[model samples]
Target: MQITPDGNIVFILPAGPLGSLPISATIVNTWIVMTILVVGGRLITLGMGPAAPASRWHLALEILIEQIRKQIQDVGGGDPGRYLPFIGTLFLFILASNVLGVVPGFTSPTGSLSTAAALAICVLVAVPFYGIADQGLLGYLRHYLRPTPLMAPLNVLGEISRTVALAIRLYGNVMSGTVIVAILLSIAPLIFPILLQLLGLLTGVVQAYIFAVLAMVYIAAAQGDEPGAA
Candidate 1:
């Protein structure tokens, strides 16, 4: 029931060799999540025969991959295959990070503003990366001018503002949920907190979906088209 906004620092590099470098719980938990995903993914796809009837695990994986590919195709327009890996990874990572908080003794790395900002920054960078890849540099930058040259500064501001909004939106939602549950546990019965935790899981999944969708939308916009537009 301890509620500190920024997570506890679990390790610090000694100042004897270099200035002290502290690593917080958020970074540690992120590494844990990454390890889980990599190991789990490898184990799940270890063996597969190219046959008519696939294993249940393989079937389920295929379905998930198909759905993600379809969503990217529908939302991002140009070659879904190109964006699938990044978008799919983003969704899965965020979803896992969000749900990890429900485990006892585990706090979601995403609850920290720094983590959220980092994720948002990834999307911010990816938007231009994909855009520049799809269209040439001049073509991608041309969008900034839009209807006229006067709108360039406003467009730049809009990009910065949206990145900030993405970070704040995710950090505020995850942090508030954690804080509320902690406060309630101190004041109310355990059953209520349990129910809230379940709801939080659902919220986490939704947030992951929203974050992924928004990222795709930004990429689509940067590529010079509206999402879902043929």
Candidate 2:
């Protein structure tokens, strides 16, 4: 067993004008996770009939949707319908990626800083996008200068800092968990590692929830609403 759980390079493209580009295990695993989510989503939504008695899968999906809607409404203080799809997809993708690490040969893409950074960048962009959409461009830009024009640079810095924090927080947790598990396997009994694996699974779920919630909070803030408002 390896002492360090670094991502393996799966393939390297020939050097071009840009340079040789290597696809790492994290990228490959992320692709797998995306494919799984897309196919599973399609399968789950197929052949729906409103008049028919709901199957367990359908019922569970309904409950999940309702819960997400409620959470968005509570945090964002407006109609939740528009935000549902983006927030739901973020939760499910992260949840799936984290859980996939439990499999024997799979590593969570989130353990890689690059992957985490990419996800954070998406949220960073989305926050501004939604803010500008909700408030006009001038309205959204004016917030940075509120109270005083001198505070504008500080406000911009805060946004950048938060985006960096979001990436690091998720990457640190997932990577540390991965490293701890690897270290345990190297020095501890197999049974102990099994227990740690179980704990890691629970932690993975919690991390996913926290990441999604934080993203929602940031979005709500961008919308100029109290994050805790109903």
Candidate 3:
């Protein structure tokens, strides 16, 4: 494994049969991120008060809550505040993991397929759960067969495809950026690497935004909203 200038360690995929194991530095980093999402997010929620305080954590969390609330309102058009906790946590975790690649000795958990796939799967499952809770199971499933009974199978396929696409899109984008920069740094250890780093920063934010937007879309769809409605 070689450490890049960004401080991310790169491990080339192994060639042999043992390459498919679930355990790796990537997996470990993902577990740490998961822990942070659960523990840190819960603490933030538990500690929040209607009265304002000057604590940095509360201030930062307030900004995050506002951002998530706006995003949900823009896309969902309902009580976005209610979903802000989970949606905000998801956004923060993903944004953190994506940006973590810039830190030394840290690999972006999102650059790994397993991690991205796991997150996408969670979003997929959560949609149905939230939908059932909000709209009832019958209403949620009725959405699948909506407008035309013949399109139910296609709707099901579309749902699964969106989840797969979310995973693959994030994995491919981050992994490709890392690989390209590695190649560039190997060939020329100069100012061009800095340009690549700048580009990575932009790409990281875009990927995070795309993931969050798609997640809202899934949740909106689950609630029987028209695709173009929101």
Candidate 4:
């Protein structure tokens, strides 16, 4: 992946296997990683007792729990506990999937538009549904119309655009990383790609964080938090 001065992004990877299904390598790898994350996270958390986290697994789970809890509190303010479950699950799932992608021959699901779009859609739908449910339809609409009448339509448009932009941003970042590394390796199978691979690792983690953080921000904004709330 190449980063441009104007903040443009580029990703490269092998041409996806062409067929009726169009299920590319990245898609398959993403599904596998996400499946493991879901199943593993469930098993790990399930083993934890209700009391203070005693075991190593429980302790790690507690740290993740605290992180999500803190993010919700920071963004959603009063009674944000209601959003804890959804936000927490999303953060952990994405974090796990992303880290798993750094493994050799694996690709970040967030690198694919399909995966990112699915996640973005979930956030987009959840935000407004939760907003109206919590604040009432009238109040929710009012929030959109606030500060000015004309800005309401624009604000709503921005909300929709935000979801689309979020998906593209992540997809571009990860896919581009994969492409650049492939190109470097093709040029010369040497120590250079090792450094690039490390860069890929960092990129994966950062992109995951950005996606998770933005998901919370979008939800918070819809719930009437100030702009840049998350």
Candidate 5:
């Protein structure tokens, strides 16, 4: 099975009628996912005015946002609204990337290590961003030097290691699912792939949920021990 989405060239765009740029399937598919999200979000809010009745899509979006906020509040134990946007985007993007793979000829960006690594890097940055926001920069930095100054290196190492683990975990699950189905398709050529594809849909959703929850936990933990910080 192909390990990276780069191997799948979805299309090429002409450059000045002289040369063409070969776009990876990952980039094309990512654009598709982003467009879907942006349009869906806009539509969901368009009908969600004081003068307008709530549509089913608006209601579903509210339920989802509230559930995400509840998760943040539970983990971080502070105002969830501050953290909701980042966490919600992460969940939705990953969910869309994985679920879209269920469609014929669509390859998931999350199945590619590059996409997974980029997301993990975002989380790595977010941990410190939220930590410094909730606590002063000095206050957040103190966590790295906790107990003793010598532990600082280990603490920093832990941070990078966990981020790497996060990327690998996400990429591995999505990649393995795709690989398994491909191999099974070659063998059965018909029915088992359909069943496995349905199972994969659930797995993809679960992976998205797990990734988001873990991200919330990481950010909340970094929010410091100060009152109202977490």
Candidate 6:
């Protein structure tokens, strides 16, 4: 594994005679996470009938979905159902990416600026999409010029800054955790480093939660307090 300038560890797959794709750890791990989530989601839904036995996976998924909805409601986003898919997807994908870092030969895609930025960009694009969808283009644009048109430039800048902040925050925290653990392993007792890694796993969940919460807040702000926007 080679560390990139951004501090992400990456593995370059060997090229094939037939021009094989060059894959990195981030891409491979992300695909793995996505596949697992997809299959798990299918399995969880398979026994939805009341006559079917409830399993631990279904119970956990229920708790997660309920919590996501609760958080959305608490934010005054109204009718959490509409926002559930977007917010829930963000949390699950991020949660999976972060939590899976504990596996051997694995590093979180969130540790890469590329992946973090891509997720942030999704939120960035989603803001205006939801805003326009709820408030109409003219209505949404009007918010930027509120108080006066002179503030429009600053409002625009704030949106861009938010996206940057989201990307850096996720990338920095995950990257630092990986780095610190690596450093400790070299100089500290073996078991101590392992303990720290387990702690890092919890930290990963916290980071994912924070990112998801912030993204939801941003979306709600963009959507204003429209009852239907939720």
How does model 5 fare in lDDT? 0.89
Higher-scoring candidate on lDDT, 5 or 6? 5
lDDT of 3 by residue, 1-230 (tens): 33222233334555587664334677668777788777877886674676745577878877877887888878876788767766776677788787777665667888888778988998899899889988988988998887899999999999899999999998888888778877888889787777887788789888888888788878977886654453
- How are the candidates ranked when ordered by lDDT, highest leading? 5, 1, 2, 6, 3, 4
- Per-residue accuracy of model 6 over 99-212 as CA lDDT, tens digit each: 888786777888888999999999999888888988999999998997799999999999999999999999999888878888777788588779978998998999888988
lDDT of 1 by residue, 30-63 (tens): 9999999899887778786675467788888889
- Against the true structure, whose lDDT is highest? 5
Which residue ranges in model 6 land beyond 4 Å of their true spot?
1-21, 226-230
* Model 4 regions more than 4 Å off: 1-27, 50-53, 227-230
Candidate 1: stretches off by over 4 Å: 1-5
Error of 6 at 118 (Å): 0.3
Which tens-of-lDDT digit does each residue in 89-172 have in candidate 5? 999999999999899888888998989999999999999999998888999999999889999999999999999999999999
Weakest 10 consecutive residues of candidate 3 by summed lDDT: 1-10
Q: Model 5 — which ten-residue stretch has the worst lDDT?
A: 221-230
Q: Please, what are the lDDT tens digits per residue for candidate 4 over residues 1-230?
A: 43211122223344557523334555566568668977887887785667755778878877877877776667666565777777766666666666766577556666667777888888888888888987899888888887898898898898889989987887788778777877888898787688887887777777766776777777777777764444
Evaluate all candidate structures by whole-model CA lDDT and list the values in order.
0.87, 0.85, 0.78, 0.72, 0.89, 0.83
Candidate 1 clashes between residue pairs 3 or more apart in a chain or in different chains: none
TM-score, candidate number 1: 0.94
lDDT, residue 33, candidate 1? 91
lDDT by residue for model 2 over 130-176, one digit each (tens)? 89999989988988896799999999999999999999998888888
Runs of candidate 2 exceeding 4 Å displacement: 1-7, 14-20
Worst-scoring 10-residue span by lDDT in model 2: 1-10
Is 1 or 6 the stronger prediction by TM-score? 1
Off by over 4 Å in 5: 12-21, 225-230
Residue-level error in angstroms, candidate 6, position 115: 0.3
Error of 6 at 85 (Å): 0.9
The clash count for each model shown is 0, 0, 1, 3, 0, 0
